[model samples]
Target: MAGFGWATHSAHKHSANRHHLRTKARMDAGFRQMNGNLERKGSLTSSYLEEPLNKTGVVSCIFSLKQEVGALVKALRLFEEKGINLTHIESRPSRNNKEEYEFFISVDQLSSKALDEVVDGLRTQISGQVHELSRNKQKDTVPWFPNDIQDLDRFANQILSYGSELDADHPGFTDPVYRARRKEFADIAYNYRHAQVIPRVEYTAEEKYCGYREDNIPQLEDISHYLQTCTGFRLRPVAGLLSSRDFLAGLAFRVFHSTQYIRHSSKPMYTPEPDICHELLGHVPLFADPSFAQFSQEIGLASLGAPDEFIEKLATVYWFTVEFGLCKEGNEVKAYGAGLLSSFGELQYCLTDKPKLLPFEPEKTCQQKYPITEFQPVYYVAESFEDAKEKVRKFASIIPRPFSVRYNAYTQRIEVLDNTQQLKNLADSISGEISILCTALRKME
Candidate 1:
């Protein structure tokens, strides 16, 4: 695409918000419904094309075409002949001409010279005036982890803006405020539809998870029981405080911390750490799926008796896969990672033009550094849960460990392979307790 010259904008002065309102109102008039907001293009604002593209090496350009039939085919044929790869395609009413429409196209791996050539080719071959209107360059950025207390306020505000609020049906606690907070968390958790990890289950009394606590929020039992029926994992409740290291060790399944430690009482949506919201909403649902449960366990199992370096790698894998991973759901991409699943702002941000999406590769994901203070600049996309599980297993197999582990459902404890006499005795002591066994083994280490 040519420089910024081709971009079109409203001649009248309009603020960014005004432009957005006008554009959104107009765009919605035609399409059935939009999953995401319309990305502004043209001279009125910063052109997306000007932004730096990331490793995905994808660039998008908008061109005008007549509403006449075969016009789109001719335009596509031009790219096919030039061997240009088109990643996405959509159309909008031309700002200059109402009768005609502008086709927005995204292409991969095409440099400035090559893109210019394609634009020139389209202009010469097509009957309509094909102009490269706007382009967006996807830039690579460091992963941002929110570590500040204030960030919670910003996150909560954004989540509320998405119309996610507490409901009466949400989980309740003895503390009225805590009960309301749990309700808000329930609303937040069920805000997004997650079909990939949460499958329907026919629960039996034997299949029900027996870990619900009185302080634990409601709806958790339903979700946890559903998960237990499917993934062989339950949503276990943890009382009071526990360090990050101890939290995962004491439970083979995911654990939800009580609401007493919840951050931001005024805005319960803001969780400084993985409180009830993060655990029950973010982690529990995923654990309900067998494949994801296995993947999670592999990471958990690999952490045992592993070097710090290996542990870090495993954590990175968990971060990408379990916390903020995305997957292809039919034609559109969907969020499955708990981090994205819980926060509306982050979830919507992932689906927006921002953030670099990389194909999930264990080595690359493990090596990639992440930030803890802000919205992630990048996320890994898996083809499916099965694909994610396979890649995770492959990565887990290479982690340096003295012993392998297998989870026995009948005993409900992890069987350590080739354990010493002392280890064997400890395992026998906690015969049916996975978390206690892991905790004992951790203390021994």
Candidate 2:
């Protein structure tokens, strides 16, 4: 994953793990803020210190629904008429959900002032509502069409997820099967693999203090007791694209991110800063389910852009809705964020009186306010995964084929058929010419 370059707002610790923060609206800054300039830490952690972002991109704006929706609708209509291509749409709640909401929108190309004017014109502020501020803002242009064959090549390159239990004996090693699988997949990336987090083991040599005082990676059996008794949420990060938006797009398509790292035995609720363990073990299982995976990909493609402010705001939406989203699951508040996967804190926090849980509303979520230092004060509850997808669809209604699995599958198959048909024609033509030559040669003979 490429590191996100963030422009910092202040030099302060946003979270316990320096990795869990962000700065400013769009500019990702350095690990340590200094001098008027928010130094580029050259890493995602130092940059988006307090601000949560999708993948590693900077997020600048969580636009107010009242302030930007009109503009957004206007922009979408204009895009339709002018053949503009839009990519992403998401919403997050304002930290204070009493009035406004935040909306995050992105397209292949950045939006311009003219476009913003159209969007702003369409924006309608509610009575006594404040428009959200913009930060690290960027407007991208519609992406040029990709070379189909090149894109095909990119798609054809497959990375399969594979791993095994740690060997334990290797000290910093995984199981022998895990070792073997890792070796097999060492060269390939952009893969979807299935791995479990073994809590009773050491993750890396850097942290040699194994919780169990044992010499092994955690296993399913070892953690079964904990899982049976597990409560709350666990956060796992699926790394998004850095530098190349397409890499992030690809992840948005289908590939889920994960790691082989396991947590120490000491912490039953182990949360690594950012690792395959947290990402894969905690998150990919959701991807395995078609509903979650489709929702993820659909939402991913539905929400692509470059403005840092927009990215930051979208991250919050993803965190609150997809990552840490709660839903009415059989008379209970269930989790969706990987962060809540195994964390006791999440289970309690999400259900506690502190959070203002609202029915998932695109407009409200977009205007919602949140802070990096505190546990979320509000979480938008979706009716279902479909409700989440609907939120994306409703936002990007003007954009056609916003993550239609049937369509993606159909197109994917069509491309295959098209390639196959071309080869078949070549083969037949070659054979026909060969036969003609043979006939001519025979006559001469």
- Which one wins on lDDT? 1
Worst 10-residue lDDT window, candidate 2: 1-10
| TM-scores, one per candidate | 0.44, 0.44
Model 2 vs. true fold: TM: 0.44
Model 1, residue 389: what's the lDDT? 72
86-128 per-residue lDDT for model 1 (tens digits): 8878777754455577777767755544676677766777745
Q: What is the lDDT of residue 254 in candidate 2?
A: 46
Q: Candidate 1 clash total?
A: 16
Off by over 4 Å in 2: 1-140, 143-248, 262-272, 304-313, 398-407, 410-445
The predictions' CA RMSDs to the true structure, in order, are: 24.8, 19.1
